[model samples]
Target: MSETENKITFEEFRKVELKVGRILSAENLPGYKKILRIIVDLGGEEREIMSGLAKHYQPEEIVNKNVIVCTNLEPRKFGDQVSDGMILAASNDNGRPILLTVVEDTNPGSQIT
Candidate 1:
């Protein structure tokens, strides 16, 4: 199908709450090889987001970085961990996750638009 055919209405698109978040910390989740438990600071609020970036990134590499986050996504459980949001990333040719981050520092919880 054409790209336009899969397009969503502006209202529908707005439903996704994309915001900037600063990674407070990142650590490998126990019993999971590819999952990392990341704590992000979205302005004053902190959220725990589970991401499958351990294979591509080290916990120390992502710590203190600013990244785009989908804050309103429904929480999902990974193993015994619950993810409160999603960290946006691009998949490379090798299907490795390349995290989406701001070129310059931005205030946490700033809207994407």
Candidate 2:
């Protein structure tokens, strides 16, 4: 496919609701080695999000970390847990998940754009 074919239109990209959220707590999901159940504070609302970060990060290590979250994504179920939003991350050369985080202190629920 050409580069243009793989690119998304600006209008399409704008539909994604990206917000800053602070991880309040993280825990391993039962029966899943790669998934973690996390509670994130999006301003006043706390959302439960399931992230594939257990392989790369300890639950205690990510607590209180500010991360980018796609808040408008439809909720997805993994086993018995339902994820309300998605935590944004990138893969490294080794294919390990590296979470996308804000460099400075930003208020929770702040728009990413």
Candidate 3:
């Protein structure tokens, strides 16, 4: 496979509402092996997202970290919980999922385009 996969039209990409958000709170969702319920402050209000990053970092470590989230993604049911958005991340050296983080001190709900 090529380093880059097949290209997508700009229009197609635009459909994904990639928004910047701040982690306001994080808590382990009971009974899940790798899920954490995260509340993101998206400027106007907060959105809840369930991400599987508990094995890599403590909930406290991710609090206040700005993140890129796909807000338009269809919410999925995890056991009994619904994930409203996707917390973007890349694989770590050990192939563990590491959520993408922001560095420019951008405000929550900032458009990523």
Candidate 4:
């Protein structure tokens, strides 16, 4: 069950480093049950993240799509990919994956809050 929302102060909210990134490439990682190895370009720098979105999107389909990422999180290694950030996405009632896309034309690494 989900808990009630806890609103935080601006100071607390500012600690989260949410940045925009463009998907440079995506490919199915062999041997994984259901994960896509994605490269996202935060301006000029590229970072990798393993997303369990393969069930909803083909690897090549999401290329060039700008996405929001939690960039300040600790790095995690999944298989050969070192995941540096998390790709934000939503789940439907049935749990289908939905990428959290940018509205308007936000620049890469733009502050979301």
Candidate 5:
């Protein structure tokens, strides 16, 4: 198949675990210019996620915000933090990252779509 036809199947897409997680806390990574280390509460469990949103968002601006995340990604270590998931965001033409937020308040770990 051509690359265009090689896209993920519906089953594969369903396997991606997208869930809403509330930002319990956020902080700048020491010595890093564009990474924010955030702790997210996924209802029953809390995990740390590293996002390159520092250039667009501040810690105080993002805290308590309900955002979407891929909960099944493999953990990655950056600096001294091990990120357990990825925060979802949209980018503008200018390449600024705009975080995806829920329309209404939902319990953390609520499935997305």
Candidate 6:
């Protein structure tokens, strides 16, 4: 795709509320080997987010880790779980995925501008 087509307008980008979320809990989704259901604390409010990280991470590997989350995405139903947000990650061609994290410790729900 061309850069023009791939680029998003500032107004359109602003619609996504990207924030930091601290993972409170994480577990493998039943019968789903590639997915993990994680509960994240976004400061005061908590949200359940389902992420496909089991291929690269274990449940114990992500708990307490602060990650960037897209808080404005429309809820998605995967299997029996309803995911309310999306965790951001960077995946390389080797298929290794790394969760995006802050350089310094920051408060949960801190807006990423």
- Give each model's whole-structure lDDT: 0.95, 0.95, 0.88, 0.87, 0.93, 0.95
How do the residues 4-111 of candidate 4 rate in per-residue lDDT, one tens digit apiece? 467678899889988899999999878786889999988768888988988889988999999999888899877767778899999999899889988787777777
lDDT of 2 at 23: 97
**Superposition error at 67 for model 3 (Å):** 0.7
Clashes of each: 0, 0, 0, 0, 0, 0
Query: Which residue pairs overlap in candidate 4's backbone?
Result: none
Tell me each candidate's RMSD, in Å, in order.
1.2, 1.0, 1.7, 2.0, 1.8, 0.9
Q: What is the lDDT of residue 97 in candidate 3?
A: 83
In candidate 5, which residue pairs clash? none
TM-score per candidate, in order? 0.93, 0.94, 0.89, 0.87, 0.93, 0.96
Kindly list the per-residue Cα lDDT of model 2 for residues 1-113, writing each as its tens digit: 99988999899999999999999999999999999999999999999999989999999999999999999999999987799999999999999988999999999999988
Cα displacement (angstroms), candidate 2, residue 56, comes to 1.0
Compare candidates 4 and 5 on TM-score and give the better one.
5
Candidate 1 lDDT over residue span 60-104, tens digit each: 999999999999999999877899999999999999988899898
Off by over 4 Å in 2: none
**19-64: candidate 5 lDDT, tens digit per residue:** 9999999999887899999999999999999999999998999999
Give residue 90's lDDT in candidate 1 (0 to 100). Answer: 96
Residue 36 deviation, candidate 3, in Å?
A: 0.8
Worst 10 residues of 2 by lDDT: 73-82
